[model samples]
Target: MRKEFDLQLDSFMLHCDAKHLSKKTLKSYDQTLRLFAKYLDVELGITDASKVKSSHIRLYIRYLRARGKYTVASSDKGLKVNYPDRREDYKKDISDTTIANYTRNIKVFFNFLKGEREIKENPMDTIEKIKPKRRQKQLLTPDELKLLFHSFDLTKFHEYRTWLQCRLILDSGIRAGECCGLKPEDIDFRSKSILVRDTKNGKERYVFFGHKMSTDLRRWLQYKDRFSDSPYIFPTVRGTQLEVNNFKLSVRNAGKSVGLEVFPHLLRNNFAKYYLIEGNGDFVTLSRLLGHSSVEVTQKAYLDFTDKEIGKKYQRHSPLNNLNI
Candidate 1:
């Protein structure tokens, strides 16, 4: 027999599916709801959403903070063999950001239940919002950037493709998934722009590239044609679309080779930082190019520039420096 909580979760997931939410979003909702349901069942012997209260949710939040990652298995199938060499530090407390995400997901689930009139009272109605502490953004120096780029062995086909993909993200500020979804037809050489179809918010937008990137892209296309006729601009050895995680791992390994920590998103972040600080670009245009829903979202992510970065930007835009006395 199915539990009442599982039944309600299934209904909510069906609603989400009807709305055409992304797979990643659906996965998040499923994971968060299932984990909460498990906690409610085991800890409080509560198997129904209608019986849940705000106090129970608060206890769950505290429990999450005290629990360690990978210590509890969602299933017993792989409990014995998973992560045999788990380090002591791997059992550390969960971060505020992760807990905040869980809180948000739980709130959304309760809201859905309330909207559907499935529950008498919303347990999350009185729960306070979780705000994660913002960490300072780190930018790569010029020499470090150069070292990272040179770490890729461009003679190999996969490495060459990765190198060009990294350069494209640095030049265009496109997300890793967006980069992976690119096709040859998406590139407009004449306009030096790419039509990005797959985006986080399900909106399509155009992102531009520099002359140097355009030249490199053209060379890459010609070289790629000599080997594989893949549908995607960046494809696997078997001519399949490259997965985002695989690309992230490739970038991470490349950075490790050069003794630096890096990822595809870091390249995108650097692109935004450079555009605003060094290129004298405006947030409005950058936000549009980066496919941000709003300029405010873009600012919230990149506005925390360091003091030296602010001074450098001011030096370039200083009125006294530009005007002759």
Candidate 2:
């Protein structure tokens, strides 16, 4: 947001505001464009937005490729950050996933500039998106889910927090950040649900919990006297709401206790897959529950996961037809 940049990202912000775009979307745009500006300043010596061109964007991509991930970014204007000394040599160049995300953001900005006549055209139009390689979705087995659940006890204080944390993540199928962002009042116990605000698409949705979780939650609420001053359901000993980094450690530690390696998203995927299977592969219901904008997004992750292979076996084992044999 500083003045030293060439591209006035302000143009993109105004266009987005006029269109009534959500705050999260606008923030993402602001993030990518600002980082683009920083990259330009550090690598290309460009300061003016009007002179921005396709090649500069291309050069930026190259820099990202050469620098790669694990490469510690130098502090802007000589500030220092303590990043661990770990880096991987990216000899193969930029990853498709990285390029795809960058391309998507810059395309948004360039297209906005074109629409406003601030630029002649969207420079990224001719450039093809880097196709990401196919990745298999990993679903935790049912035993894994059981192991995860049985890992913690609600009787002890530390175990109770872990129990509450995993229970919310699994039952609600919410992102780890959303779960930690939760406050006690956000839960509608009478309705057996919790509000997940600004989920993936900046959409607020209610996720219902199971009977067991609702009960465990009540017992945990008894201990709510501890975090009364803070708004988050889970807070630190010091009484502040939890942050992402702290949540990562807490979630990881909870995972360690269960003898099951779990990440927050894996629990979410378990929620989706189980529901879809139980619903007999119902896409519409699953999509709404997970707060995905489209069923296709839900399908993309769970379709393969729930496809039934036993239909042929049922037909092969039909007893009525066997009587004729």
Candidate 3:
């Protein structure tokens, strides 16, 4: 029989399942732990978690860093078979963000082990969480956004829905997933607020739209009802809920037609920035509007303002400029 420490990972997975974690998150945790187990076996020849030490974990981190991209076949099932065949051509280096996520999953697994008293000492005690650099996302100018809106061929059903969805995202900074998952009934026409049932954090929130977006959405709904009996506000030709990737591709292609490279998230970023700068730097309200856990997270992700933008904001808020002193 496998020892308690040896089967600790299985126990942890069961714990995750009981907590009702998303399938995607559970898969990531399983895959990361499998790779760590493989590292322990091949390098340190340790089969028991109790025998694993902080030093061994450090060695594995270095091993991950030294390994080239694609070289580390996902020790996870199904992907494991192609590892030996594709190892030679694995030249892309693992990104720091990906490495950080892997480290996080490892930490979570070991933390579970400690909590269950499966191990006397925690191997992750000395391991510090890696903070990856935040990449700045591009935002579209007002003119660019206007041009993108016009680029859509409104006559086509898909294009019309895509155009309306883009406007909705810009008006309310709900995530792409949340937008695509919306049903016709989710929108409270009288309140002009959408009830977001599906979100990344698994918590429901409300996202509000402006007058212009409300008008467009109402018109789209009327038009959409004539063609499809789908429950979703935006549906495929077959009247099924629109796939997120298909929605993104539709938006991306429209941007290309207008000589711009826009994506759904960019519109979200644009919304946040516009809300902050034009709406008098209301970070608290913006945080709630974007459905972030906290204002700090919202700041950390979106506080990267250019000097020109800052100057523009300053001109509006300058007491002397407003007072004409």
Cα-based TM-score, every candidate: 0.92, 0.79, 0.81
Candidate 3 C-alpha error for residue 39, in Å: 5.2
| Count of residue pairs whose backbone atoms collide, per candidate | 0, 3, 1
Residue by residue across 171-221, what tens digits does model 2's lDDT show? Answer: 777877777778888898899988887566677888888888888788777
- For residues 245-325, what per-residue lDDT tens digits would candidate 3 score against the true structure? 789888988999989988899999989988878877588888888888899999888889888878989999889988956
**Candidate 1 Cα misplacement greater than 4 A, ranges:** 76-89
Tens digit per residue, CA lDDT, model 1, 89-175:
466887889889988888889889988988767788798888888877789999999999999889999999999999999999999
Candidate 2 residue spans exceeding 4 A from truth? 1-7, 11-27, 70-95, 149-159, 253-261, 279-281, 306-325
How well does model 1 score by local distance difference test?
0.89
Query: Which model is ahead, 1 or 3, in terms of lDDT?
Result: 1
Pairing residues by index, what is the TM-score of model 3? 0.81
The 0-to-1 C-alpha lDDT of every candidate, in the order given, reads 0.89, 0.69, 0.83
